[model samples]
Target: MISHAKIPFVVFETEPENAQRARDWNFGIHWSVPLLQDLMPPELFAKLASTRVDPHRPVQPSETLRFLNGATGIEIGAAFIPHLYRVQRSKLRALLAEGIPIQYDKAISTISYTEDGSTVAAHFEDGTTVSGTILIGADGTRSKVRNLLLGEEKAALDRLEYAALWVQAKYTAEQVKYLRSGHPLFLACCHPLGYFGWLGTHSAPDQDVPEEWVMNCYISYKEPIAEQEKCKKWPNEGNLGEVKALAELCFAEPFKSAFGWLGDEQEVWYSPLTQWDPSLPEHQWDNHSGRVTLAGDAAHPMTYQRGQGANFAIKDSLELVNHIGSFLDSETKGRKEAVRVYEQETKERAGEEVRLSYQNTEMVHVWEKVLQSPIMKHGLNPTS
Candidate 1:
């Protein structure tokens, strides 16, 4: 399972009644399963929970405030309180002690399906080939296997018309103390043009540097030609001068200070927002007409707006594995039935997520309509 160790858990706080209302409105009609709740010690829960805004308090509408206007009025989205922990890679090694063969550094070149249904082969960029009974394309968004399977029908990625610039920097304890006095770690400010920005800290327990915070600045605007041009460069090797300049221009003073802390221009990471359509069909290949499938972002690359990419990927892997395990144990069904069952189940579940993710994209980028939405205004509570 993909673990969420590095990214802080973000919990938004609102009145319980309002929260329930939102739940009913947004998910009630669509979901039949009970929503998962975090069960942690009270102290840990309190520590993890940081208020984005006091929904009970009055808010002065300002041109710069960032919020998703609710059905009744404005609702705030908050970040997680910074409680950092250094990820011990050793723990990961211990978990993988079962001697599961791990592949590292070698990039997959091509995945080929034999005309008959028996073997699937993967050719690596290093001129090595590996054959396996089952082939899963865990490779991300622009999946090589997926393209090969679908031939000309591969789905195209839709740009979300936003960009995020991220950097990690050191801050003095004194500076952090001063900043935290007024603005909490989870706080964010909204702009009139539907743009929002946030700042948060990551500090490990019993650690010396509580001041060091990873700064993530997100700006929403129509995708400019220049930003699109930059995305063409290989990630981490692209020219980010123009993007950095634009971030400095759009962000406020606090964010400006945060940006200034980045000493090297090359260190900043720029990501152009893009989402995959959920309606796209899953890719399938044959073993001389046998059984192989694609899963995860290789099957469905969604916007990070809902933070469901990793979650859904893990879910896909688990579901697929369970199906395969069951099929292996069965004597009658055989490989073809197992493959069919796995594909059918995966599409049903992952497809729904893809659709929901696409809807969230519409809600965020299509702000004018979303602003007046009944769900946004009243949440789940209907006005009397």
Candidate 2:
């Protein structure tokens, strides 16, 4: 949007670009592909194919999603669009951040408005400040900008009573073939034992070279967080044993076989699902008369069950660009009105998504209710 508008803007990134972290989850870009293709250059959009987990079936009408333990599998796909494209989060970010005016290591501290309230300034923890006509909190789930706008209590993430443990590891040729028996890119299974199993290729460096492929597998179950407990805890670095034990108990056949390939030296990570609803009354905050607002997950964070988080975030961004574009082109419409309209639409659209995803999250964990979930019925499309 900045490049198209020819507007001056700077992005403050909380972490350095090269900072090492675990391989993030893959995004299933289905309904938003047209929006992304329109926003990005043809060459850039073409480059995304290299990041595909399964280059073989990049654009199919339907995906064969497998299930385990006698539970029925689903062939879910969008009617208007083909099957979703699965791309690594890292690769997608690199593609999107190609040439933006981004400043790394600039963590947000607070937001202050101009005395006349025509502009907003963001103060960073690095003892620096930047002022702009508008401040957009595009940060992730635990956004600092959200805190300053809505206060600490309102900005807190709404935790769900579910959790997952993930492990990313390389596999032998035979192991890769065994895991791929279900699907090439990703597989989702709901067990009759009240657990969810997910296995996917994290990075397939070379499709011909199976040894270079890294697979990510995780088992999710109902792990209700106590009211006082803040986070889920387990052996972080070298705890493949614990995760594998849980997987053995939860999965069957191919899913279990995939986790059995994990070596003891591998790393394990735990995540307690959480989300934020911008539509909620308590989440309302002073937008500094439209000079200050949020975009992306900072505005609405939803559970990943329906794979709508990134889709909605992208939708929020593109719609916001359209709103701002209209505001810039119109002489009569106030900027406040532009931002207000954008936010209202986002709250209504993304807010319902958050609620549906939360419900999907709950339903997927229970075997008896899994098939009746929205995802099983309508696939990974947006609810609202």
Candidate 3:
């Protein structure tokens, strides 16, 4: 919207340019298609086709499979869904930021307001400052903007009992085909031992070259009380053996084979799952008289179980644009009310999404409750 309006604004990125590309792939689901379609040009929206996990095997909407005991337990249906694109996030961002002004590697040190209080300023660690009429904190979970608004103690994310590990690996043509025996794009399963496994195609060769293809597999589970301390070492230790042992023990067929592709030297990214409950008093803030506010994961971080995280972020941006547009209109004089309205709507809407995602996260690891989980029952549809 800012780009369309020719509004002058600059972005501060904590990472260097192209750094996000390393994160590889993510899903763009049905819920945000209409908004994105409107936001993006038809030609650009059409480029999502190039990012498909299996372009040669294109279908209207590919179903995500869930398994139990080596058998398919549930298939997340595609009915009523318009687009389910596997997005290369960096590619999408590069397309959207075609002419936008962005300064990479600018990390925020502090946030403050002008003496007159009509403007907000962000102080960067590099000894530079940028001020604007309004500041939107679109940063991720550990957002410095949020910490400045709510204070360190209150802004801390609530760590869940679960742990997740992701391993990115390359495969030969034969191995790639065998690994995708379950699904060409993504599939997940829960074992009776209380572990959940997800395998997905991160990148595929257009020319069908074996060595050019890449995939990622991850396992998440509730950590046992006795081993919680040891799990912290998994990330820095750069180990895949333990993860391999667990997958071999709990999963079957393609899932096990995917894990087997993990070389002992391959890097593993590990984290203890965490979330922020937006409804909590400590998590709420004054919004600094409408000059400052939060958006996306910076406001309400939740588990990826329900896949609403990015959708809500997009929703927040749309709502913010709507309210800010109203405020900017000459017919209205509610300058501060614009941010207040955005906050109210985001608080209620994203708060509910955070709750539902947390609930789904808890249920997904437990085999018996997995089918009854909200995601399994409703697919990726939003919960009001």
Q: Write the per-residue lDDT of candidate 2 for residues 1-384, one digit (tens) a residue.
A: 335644467878898877766556677788887777766777788887766776645567756555555233343222232557788888788888887788998988888888997889999888999988889999988888898888899999997788877878888898898888777777777877777778888888777888888898887777668821543444454346766776666556677777776776777777778899989999987888999888888988888867888888778778877778777878998889999999899988988988898888888877789778878777777755
Query: Which residue pairs collide in model 2, if any?
Result: none
TM-score of each: 0.62, 0.92, 0.91
Predicted candidate 3 versus true structure: per-residue lDDT over 1-384, tens digit per residue: 435443457888998887745466566556786777666667777776665655556756546555544333344332233467666565567777776689999999898887777999899999999889888898998888889888889999887888888887887788888887767777777766777778888777575585677787888889753466676655534457777777676667677888776766777777678888777776789777789999999999998867788788878877877777777764765658888888888888888878888888888877778778877777788877
Off by over 4 Å in 2: 1-4, 55-62, 70-83, 227-231, 237-239
C-alpha lDDT of all candidate models, in order: 0.47, 0.77, 0.75
The residue-by-residue lDDT of candidate 1 on 209-242, one tens digit each, is 5554332334444466576676656465343454
- Tell me the deviation in Å of residue 92 in model 1: 7.1
Given candidate 3, what's the lDDT at residue 33?
A: 69
* Worst-scoring 10-residue span by lDDT in model 1: 22-31
How far off is residue 230 in model 1, in Å?
Answer: 6.2
Model 3 regions lying over 4 Å from their true place: 2-6, 20-22, 53-59, 70-81, 224-227, 235-238
In model 1, the Cα lDDT at residue 362 comes to: 49
Report the lDDT of model 1 for residue 19.
Answer: 23
